[model samples]
Target: MQITQLPSDQRPREKLLQQGPQALSDAELLAIFFRTGIAGMNAIELAETTLSTHQSLQQLFNASLGDFCQVKGLGEAKYVQLQAVLELSKRFLQESCQRNTVFNSPEHVRHYLSLELKSRQQEVFMVLFLDNQNRLIHQDILFYGTINSASVYPREVVKAVLRHNAAAVIFAHNHPSGVAEPSEADKIITRKLISALALIDVPVLDHLIVADVSVISFAERGLI
Candidate 1:
Protein backbone atom coordinates (compact mmCIF):
# COMPACT_ATOMS: atom_id res chain seq x y z
CA MET A 1 0.00 0.00 0.00
CA GLN A 2 1.06 3.59 -0.61
CA ILE A 3 2.55 5.45 2.37
CA THR A 4 0.01 8.28 1.95
CA GLN A 5 -2.86 5.78 2.04
CA LEU A 6 -1.66 4.38 5.36
CA PRO A 7 -3.06 5.69 8.67
CA SER A 8 -1.48 9.01 9.70
CA ASP A 9 0.05 7.58 12.89
CA GLN A 10 1.51 4.59 11.03
CA ARG A 11 3.38 6.69 8.44
CA PRO A 12 7.12 6.88 8.84
CA ARG A 13 7.38 10.68 9.03
CA GLU A 14 4.37 11.06 11.29
CA LYS A 15 5.57 8.23 13.50
CA LEU A 16 8.99 9.88 13.76
CA LEU A 17 7.45 13.26 14.73
CA GLN A 18 5.15 11.72 17.32
CA GLN A 19 7.36 9.20 19.07
CA GLY A 20 10.92 10.19 18.17
CA PRO A 21 13.30 8.43 15.76
CA GLN A 22 13.96 5.44 18.00
CA ALA A 23 10.34 4.35 17.77
CA LEU A 24 10.70 3.54 14.07
CA SER A 25 12.19 0.44 12.52
CA ASP A 26 15.18 0.59 10.13
CA ALA A 27 12.89 0.34 7.09
CA GLU A 28 10.70 3.16 8.40
CA LEU A 29 13.70 5.43 8.92
CA LEU A 30 15.06 4.61 5.49
CA ALA A 31 11.60 5.12 3.94
CA ILE A 32 11.56 8.67 5.30
CA PHE A 33 14.94 9.25 3.67
CA PHE A 34 13.68 7.76 0.43
CA ARG A 35 10.54 9.95 0.42
CA THR A 36 9.27 8.28 -2.74
CA GLY A 37 9.45 4.92 -4.40
CA ILE A 38 9.32 3.26 -7.82
CA ALA A 39 6.17 2.54 -9.84
CA GLY A 40 4.90 -0.48 -7.88
CA MET A 41 6.76 -0.42 -4.55
CA ASN A 42 5.98 2.13 -1.84
CA ALA A 43 8.79 3.91 0.02
CA ILE A 44 8.66 1.43 2.89
CA GLU A 45 8.70 -1.54 0.54
CA LEU A 46 11.54 0.00 -1.45
CA ALA A 47 13.52 0.53 1.72
CA GLU A 48 12.90 -3.06 2.77
CA THR A 49 14.04 -4.33 -0.60
CA THR A 50 17.15 -2.17 -0.55
CA LEU A 51 18.08 -3.30 2.94
CA SER A 52 17.61 -6.91 1.94
CA THR A 53 19.83 -6.43 -1.10
CA HIS A 54 22.65 -4.95 0.98
CA GLN A 55 21.99 -7.27 3.95
CA SER A 56 22.49 -4.49 6.49
CA LEU A 57 22.62 -0.71 6.91
CA GLN A 58 26.36 -0.93 7.43
CA GLN A 59 26.90 -2.67 4.09
CA LEU A 60 24.64 -0.16 2.34
CA PHE A 61 26.40 2.80 3.94
CA ASN A 62 29.82 1.39 3.05
CA ALA A 63 28.96 0.65 -0.59
CA SER A 64 30.86 2.56 -3.26
CA LEU A 65 28.99 4.89 -5.61
CA GLY A 66 28.91 2.30 -8.37
CA ASP A 67 27.70 -0.39 -6.02
CA PHE A 68 25.14 1.87 -4.38
CA CYS A 69 23.68 3.10 -7.66
CA GLN A 70 23.25 -0.43 -8.84
CA VAL A 71 20.38 -0.86 -6.39
CA LYS A 72 16.91 -0.39 -7.80
CA GLY A 73 15.52 3.17 -7.34
CA LEU A 74 18.90 4.41 -6.14
CA GLY A 75 21.30 6.70 -7.95
CA GLU A 76 24.34 8.95 -7.58
CA ALA A 77 22.29 11.55 -5.74
CA LYS A 78 21.39 9.05 -3.04
CA TYR A 79 25.00 7.90 -2.82
CA VAL A 80 26.16 11.50 -2.28
CA GLN A 81 23.53 12.03 0.38
CA LEU A 82 24.56 8.83 2.14
CA GLN A 83 28.21 9.90 2.09
CA ALA A 84 27.29 13.30 3.52
CA VAL A 85 25.35 11.66 6.34
CA LEU A 86 28.28 9.35 7.08
CA GLU A 87 30.78 12.22 7.18
CA LEU A 88 28.47 14.24 9.44
CA SER A 89 28.20 11.29 11.84
CA LYS A 90 32.00 10.91 11.89
CA ARG A 91 32.48 14.63 12.57
CA PHE A 92 29.89 14.59 15.34
CA LEU A 93 31.65 11.66 17.01
CA GLN A 94 35.00 13.41 16.64
CA GLU A 95 33.61 16.59 18.21
CA SER A 96 32.36 14.49 21.09
CA CYS A 97 35.78 12.87 21.46
CA GLN A 98 37.45 16.27 21.53
CA ARG A 99 35.09 17.59 24.21
CA ASN A 100 35.45 14.69 26.69
CA THR A 101 38.27 12.82 28.36
CA VAL A 102 39.06 10.13 25.75
CA PHE A 103 39.80 7.34 28.25
CA ASN A 104 36.56 8.07 30.07
CA SER A 105 34.59 7.96 26.81
CA PRO A 106 36.42 5.19 25.06
CA GLU A 107 33.37 4.18 23.01
CA HIS A 108 33.30 7.59 21.31
CA VAL A 109 36.92 7.18 20.30
CA ARG A 110 36.20 3.65 19.07
CA HIS A 111 33.22 4.83 17.00
CA TYR A 112 35.16 7.70 15.48
CA LEU A 113 38.01 5.38 14.62
CA SER A 114 35.60 2.82 13.16
CA LEU A 115 34.00 5.39 10.88
CA GLU A 116 37.43 6.62 9.81
CA LEU A 117 39.05 3.22 9.34
CA LYS A 118 36.47 0.43 9.01
CA SER A 119 35.82 0.79 5.27
CA ARG A 120 39.45 1.21 4.33
CA GLN A 121 40.90 -1.42 1.97
CA GLN A 122 44.45 -0.97 3.24
CA GLU A 123 46.16 -0.73 6.61
CA VAL A 124 46.59 2.68 8.24
CA PHE A 125 47.99 3.75 11.60
CA MET A 126 46.36 6.58 13.51
CA VAL A 127 47.47 8.29 16.69
CA LEU A 128 45.38 10.39 19.01
CA PHE A 129 47.47 12.94 20.90
CA LEU A 130 45.94 13.76 24.24
CA ASP A 131 46.31 16.54 26.77
CA ASN A 132 47.24 15.78 30.39
CA GLN A 133 43.53 15.54 31.17
CA ASN A 134 43.08 12.96 28.39
CA ARG A 135 41.10 15.20 26.04
CA LEU A 136 42.07 14.94 22.41
CA ILE A 137 44.65 17.55 21.39
CA HIS A 138 45.21 16.30 17.85
CA GLN A 139 44.93 13.20 15.69
CA ASP A 140 46.84 12.09 12.62
CA ILE A 141 47.41 9.08 10.40
CA LEU A 142 51.16 8.73 10.76
CA PHE A 143 51.69 5.78 8.45
CA TYR A 144 50.07 4.13 5.45
CA GLY A 145 50.43 0.78 3.61
CA THR A 146 51.28 -2.24 5.76
CA ILE A 147 51.18 -1.48 9.51
CA ASN A 148 54.17 -3.24 11.07
CA SER A 149 57.51 -2.69 12.83
CA ALA A 150 59.32 -1.85 9.60
CA SER A 151 56.64 0.39 8.07
CA VAL A 152 55.66 2.37 11.19
CA TYR A 153 58.45 4.54 12.56
CA PRO A 154 58.49 5.46 16.25
CA ARG A 155 60.69 8.48 15.41
CA GLU A 156 57.96 10.03 13.25
CA VAL A 157 55.34 9.32 15.92
CA VAL A 158 57.63 10.97 18.50
CA LYS A 159 57.97 13.98 16.20
CA ALA A 160 54.20 14.27 15.89
CA VAL A 161 53.70 13.93 19.66
CA LEU A 162 56.34 16.60 20.30
CA ARG A 163 54.78 18.86 17.70
CA HIS A 164 51.37 18.51 19.29
CA ASN A 165 52.87 18.86 22.80
CA ALA A 166 50.74 15.86 23.80
CA ALA A 167 51.03 14.47 27.34
CA ALA A 168 49.90 10.99 26.26
CA VAL A 169 48.80 9.02 23.18
CA ILE A 170 46.34 6.40 22.04
CA PHE A 171 47.31 4.30 19.04
CA ALA A 172 44.96 2.70 16.53
CA HIS A 173 45.27 0.69 13.34
CA ASN A 174 42.84 -1.03 10.99
CA HIS A 175 42.98 -4.67 9.95
CA PRO A 176 41.60 -5.04 6.43
CA SER A 177 41.34 -8.79 6.97
CA GLY A 178 38.63 -8.22 9.60
CA VAL A 179 40.56 -9.84 12.45
CA ALA A 180 40.48 -7.75 15.62
CA GLU A 181 43.11 -9.84 17.37
CA PRO A 182 46.49 -8.16 17.67
CA SER A 183 49.19 -9.98 15.75
CA GLU A 184 52.73 -10.68 16.99
CA ALA A 185 53.85 -7.80 14.80
CA ASP A 186 51.26 -5.59 16.42
CA LYS A 187 52.54 -6.45 19.92
CA ILE A 188 56.18 -5.94 18.92
CA ILE A 189 55.55 -2.52 17.33
CA THR A 190 53.41 -1.35 20.27
CA ARG A 191 56.13 -2.25 22.79
CA LYS A 192 58.73 -0.47 20.66
CA LEU A 193 56.51 2.62 20.53
CA ILE A 194 56.00 2.43 24.29
CA SER A 195 59.75 2.29 24.87
CA ALA A 196 60.39 5.18 22.47
CA LEU A 197 57.68 7.41 23.99
CA ALA A 198 58.64 6.52 27.57
CA LEU A 199 62.07 8.08 27.08
CA ILE A 200 60.29 11.43 26.60
CA ASP A 201 57.89 10.74 29.54
CA VAL A 202 54.80 10.32 27.33
CA PRO A 203 52.51 7.46 28.24
CA VAL A 204 50.85 5.11 25.76
CA LEU A 205 47.30 5.07 27.00
CA ASP A 206 45.84 2.38 24.73
CA HIS A 207 46.23 0.61 21.43
CA LEU A 208 43.03 -0.13 19.52
CA ILE A 209 42.57 -2.35 16.48
CA VAL A 210 39.67 -1.61 14.17
CA ALA A 211 38.17 -4.62 12.43
CA ASP A 212 35.08 -5.14 10.25
CA VAL A 213 32.55 -5.35 13.08
CA SER A 214 34.55 -4.66 16.23
CA VAL A 215 37.20 -2.44 17.76
CA ILE A 216 39.61 -4.36 20.01
CA SER A 217 41.35 -2.46 22.80
CA PHE A 218 44.72 -3.61 24.07
CA ALA A 219 44.07 -2.08 27.47
CA GLU A 220 40.70 -3.83 27.80
CA ARG A 221 42.34 -7.17 26.98
CA GLY A 222 45.24 -6.44 29.39
CA LEU A 223 47.61 -6.53 26.41
CA ILE A 224 48.87 -3.05 27.29
Candidate 2:
Protein backbone atom coordinates (compact mmCIF):
# COMPACT_ATOMS: atom_id res chain seq x y z
CA MET A 1 0.00 0.00 0.00
CA GLN A 2 1.15 3.55 -0.64
CA ILE A 3 2.27 5.70 2.30
CA THR A 4 -0.37 8.31 1.38
CA GLN A 5 -3.04 5.61 1.59
CA LEU A 6 -2.05 4.65 5.12
CA PRO A 7 -4.12 5.98 8.05
CA SER A 8 -3.09 9.58 8.72
CA ASP A 9 -1.85 8.87 12.26
CA GLN A 10 0.10 5.82 11.06
CA ARG A 11 2.09 7.74 8.49
CA PRO A 12 5.74 8.32 9.31
CA ARG A 13 5.76 12.11 8.93
CA GLU A 14 2.44 12.58 10.68
CA LYS A 15 3.51 10.29 13.51
CA LEU A 16 6.76 12.22 13.85
CA LEU A 17 4.93 15.57 13.99
CA GLN A 18 2.25 14.32 16.42
CA GLN A 19 4.61 12.61 18.83
CA GLY A 20 8.34 13.15 18.55
CA PRO A 21 11.28 11.75 16.60
CA GLN A 22 12.10 9.34 19.43
CA ALA A 23 8.67 7.75 19.19
CA LEU A 24 9.26 6.26 15.74
CA SER A 25 10.97 3.04 14.65
CA ASP A 26 14.13 3.07 12.54
CA ALA A 27 12.27 2.28 9.32
CA GLU A 28 9.67 4.91 10.05
CA LEU A 29 12.32 7.56 10.63
CA LEU A 30 14.15 6.53 7.48
CA ALA A 31 10.88 6.63 5.53
CA ILE A 32 10.43 10.24 6.52
CA PHE A 33 13.87 10.96 5.10
CA PHE A 34 13.13 8.99 1.93
CA ARG A 35 9.90 10.98 1.27
CA THR A 36 9.08 8.92 -1.85
CA GLY A 37 9.60 5.42 -3.09
CA ILE A 38 9.81 3.34 -6.27
CA ALA A 39 6.65 2.28 -8.18
CA GLY A 40 5.76 -0.91 -6.29
CA MET A 41 7.13 -0.01 -2.81
CA ASN A 42 5.96 2.70 -0.45
CA ALA A 43 8.53 4.86 1.36
CA ILE A 44 8.12 2.76 4.49
CA GLU A 45 8.61 -0.44 2.52
CA LEU A 46 11.65 0.94 0.78
CA ALA A 47 13.15 1.98 4.10
CA GLU A 48 12.44 -1.46 5.52
CA THR A 49 14.12 -3.11 2.54
CA THR A 50 17.15 -0.84 2.80
CA LEU A 51 17.60 -1.41 6.52
CA SER A 52 17.19 -5.14 6.08
CA THR A 53 19.92 -5.15 3.43
CA HIS A 54 22.32 -3.12 5.59
CA GLN A 55 21.38 -4.94 8.84
CA SER A 56 21.72 -1.73 10.90
CA LEU A 57 21.60 2.05 10.49
CA GLN A 58 25.25 2.41 11.50
CA GLN A 59 26.39 -0.02 8.82
CA LEU A 60 24.22 1.77 6.31
CA PHE A 61 25.58 5.26 7.07
CA ASN A 62 29.15 3.99 7.16
CA ALA A 63 28.78 2.60 3.67
CA SER A 64 30.66 4.38 0.91
CA LEU A 65 28.73 6.54 -1.57
CA GLY A 66 29.24 3.93 -4.30
CA ASP A 67 28.06 1.15 -2.02
CA PHE A 68 24.98 3.09 -0.94
CA CYS A 69 24.13 4.20 -4.49
CA GLN A 70 23.81 0.55 -5.47
CA VAL A 71 20.63 0.40 -3.38
CA LYS A 72 17.38 0.58 -5.30
CA GLY A 73 15.68 4.00 -5.58
CA LEU A 74 18.79 5.81 -4.29
CA GLY A 75 21.25 7.87 -6.32
CA GLU A 76 24.18 10.26 -5.96
CA ALA A 77 21.95 13.18 -4.96
CA LYS A 78 20.59 11.37 -1.91
CA TYR A 79 24.05 10.06 -1.14
CA VAL A 80 25.37 13.63 -1.11
CA GLN A 81 22.54 14.69 1.16
CA LEU A 82 23.29 11.86 3.57
CA GLN A 83 27.00 12.71 3.63
CA ALA A 84 26.19 16.40 4.24
CA VAL A 85 23.91 15.49 7.12
CA LEU A 86 26.62 13.27 8.58
CA GLU A 87 29.25 16.00 8.39
CA LEU A 88 26.85 18.46 10.00
CA SER A 89 26.08 16.04 12.83
CA LYS A 90 29.78 15.48 13.46
CA ARG A 91 30.43 19.23 13.58
CA PHE A 92 27.59 19.67 16.04
CA LEU A 93 29.05 16.96 18.24
CA GLN A 94 32.49 18.56 18.00
CA GLU A 95 31.02 21.89 19.07
CA SER A 96 29.30 20.22 22.00
CA CYS A 97 32.57 18.61 23.05
CA GLN A 98 34.31 21.97 22.90
CA ARG A 99 31.72 23.52 25.19
CA ASN A 100 32.17 20.93 27.94
CA THR A 101 35.22 19.89 29.88
CA VAL A 102 36.44 16.35 29.17
CA PHE A 103 37.34 15.36 32.75
CA ASN A 104 33.82 16.11 33.97
CA SER A 105 32.24 15.22 30.64
CA PRO A 106 33.30 11.67 30.01
CA GLU A 107 30.19 10.87 28.02
CA HIS A 108 30.81 13.70 25.54
CA VAL A 109 34.41 12.65 25.12
CA ARG A 110 33.46 9.03 24.50
CA HIS A 111 30.61 9.94 22.17
CA TYR A 112 32.73 12.33 20.14
CA LEU A 113 35.63 9.90 19.92
CA SER A 114 33.33 7.07 18.86
CA LEU A 115 31.94 9.12 16.00
CA GLU A 116 35.40 10.24 14.95
CA LEU A 117 37.05 6.83 15.06
CA LYS A 118 34.53 4.00 14.95
CA SER A 119 33.86 3.93 11.20
CA ARG A 120 37.48 4.15 10.15
CA GLN A 121 38.75 1.12 8.22
CA GLN A 122 42.38 1.84 9.12
CA GLU A 123 44.03 2.59 12.44
CA VAL A 124 44.04 6.28 13.41
CA PHE A 125 45.68 8.02 16.35
CA MET A 126 44.08 11.23 17.55
CA VAL A 127 44.51 13.67 20.39
CA LEU A 128 42.06 15.96 22.11
CA PHE A 129 43.96 19.04 23.19
CA LEU A 130 42.52 20.52 26.33
CA ASP A 131 42.79 23.87 28.01
CA ASN A 132 43.79 24.40 31.64
CA GLN A 133 40.22 23.72 32.79
CA ASN A 134 40.11 20.47 30.74
CA ARG A 135 37.86 22.03 28.09
CA LEU A 136 38.56 20.86 24.59
CA ILE A 137 40.76 23.16 22.55
CA HIS A 138 40.93 21.15 19.36
CA GLN A 139 41.17 17.65 18.03
CA ASP A 140 43.82 16.47 15.59
CA ILE A 141 44.43 13.18 13.87
CA LEU A 142 48.19 12.97 14.07
CA PHE A 143 48.70 9.58 12.54
CA TYR A 144 46.78 7.26 10.27
CA GLY A 145 48.04 3.96 8.95
CA THR A 146 49.02 0.87 10.91
CA ILE A 147 49.11 1.38 14.69
CA ASN A 148 52.12 0.19 16.66
CA SER A 149 54.75 1.39 19.14
CA ALA A 150 57.09 2.41 16.33
CA SER A 151 54.50 4.09 14.11
CA VAL A 152 52.91 6.34 16.79
CA TYR A 153 55.96 8.43 17.57
CA PRO A 154 56.17 10.53 20.74
CA ARG A 155 58.35 13.15 19.06
CA GLU A 156 55.65 14.03 16.52
CA VAL A 157 53.08 14.01 19.31
CA VAL A 158 55.25 16.29 21.40
CA LYS A 159 55.56 18.62 18.43
CA ALA A 160 51.80 18.76 18.10
CA VAL A 161 51.47 19.29 21.86
CA LEU A 162 53.84 22.23 21.65
CA ARG A 163 52.02 23.52 18.58
CA HIS A 164 48.63 23.44 20.29
CA ASN A 165 50.15 24.65 23.58
CA ALA A 166 47.67 22.39 25.31
CA ALA A 167 47.81 22.06 29.05
CA ALA A 168 46.53 18.49 28.96
CA VAL A 169 45.36 15.89 26.47
CA ILE A 170 43.29 12.74 26.20
CA PHE A 171 44.65 10.29 23.70
CA ALA A 172 42.61 7.99 21.52
CA HIS A 173 42.98 5.45 18.73
CA ASN A 174 40.72 3.02 16.92
CA HIS A 175 40.85 -0.75 16.68
CA PRO A 176 39.48 -1.53 13.24
CA SER A 177 39.47 -5.17 14.26
CA GLY A 178 36.68 -4.25 16.75
CA VAL A 179 38.47 -5.33 19.91
CA ALA A 180 38.48 -2.74 22.68
CA GLU A 181 41.01 -4.63 24.74
CA PRO A 182 44.25 -2.70 24.95
CA SER A 183 47.21 -4.50 23.47
CA GLU A 184 50.70 -4.66 25.02
CA ALA A 185 51.80 -2.18 22.36
CA ASP A 186 48.88 0.10 23.31
CA LYS A 187 49.94 0.10 26.97
CA ILE A 188 53.53 0.71 26.08
CA ILE A 189 52.64 3.69 23.87
CA THR A 190 50.31 5.18 26.48
CA ARG A 191 53.07 5.05 29.06
CA LYS A 192 55.46 6.61 26.57
CA LEU A 193 53.02 9.43 25.85
CA ILE A 194 52.47 9.93 29.58
CA SER A 195 56.18 10.22 30.15
CA ALA A 196 56.84 12.40 27.10
CA LEU A 197 53.96 14.80 27.74
CA ALA A 198 54.80 15.02 31.44
CA LEU A 199 58.22 16.43 30.57
CA ILE A 200 56.44 19.48 29.09
CA ASP A 201 54.39 19.98 32.28
CA VAL A 202 51.34 18.54 30.56
CA PRO A 203 49.41 15.50 31.76
CA VAL A 204 48.00 12.56 29.87
CA LEU A 205 44.53 12.35 31.32
CA ASP A 206 43.34 9.17 29.59
CA HIS A 207 43.97 6.87 26.69
CA LEU A 208 40.81 5.56 25.04
CA ILE A 209 40.75 2.64 22.64
CA VAL A 210 37.72 2.86 20.37
CA ALA A 211 36.16 -0.31 19.00
CA ASP A 212 32.86 -0.76 17.20
CA VAL A 213 30.83 -1.86 20.23
CA SER A 214 32.73 -0.33 23.14
CA VAL A 215 35.41 2.16 24.20
CA ILE A 216 38.11 0.99 26.58
CA SER A 217 39.49 3.62 28.93
CA PHE A 218 42.92 3.25 30.42
CA ALA A 219 42.07 5.70 33.20
CA GLU A 220 39.01 3.67 34.15
CA ARG A 221 41.17 0.53 34.13
CA GLY A 222 43.71 2.15 36.52
CA LEU A 223 46.35 2.23 33.80
CA ILE A 224 46.57 6.05 33.93
Off by over 4 Å in 1: 147-150
TM per candidate? 0.95, 0.94
Name the candidate that leads on lDDT.
Answer: 1
Worst lDDT run of 10 residues, candidate 2, spans: 143-152
lDDT of each: 0.92, 0.89
lDDT (Cα, tens digit) per residue for candidate 1, span 111-159: 9999999988889999999999999998999988853322699999999
Deviation in angstroms for 164 in model 2? Answer: 0.8
Residue 169 of model 1: what lDDT? 100
- Please, what are the lDDT tens digits per residue for candidate 2 over residues 119-178? 988899999999999999988999888643226899999999899989999999999888
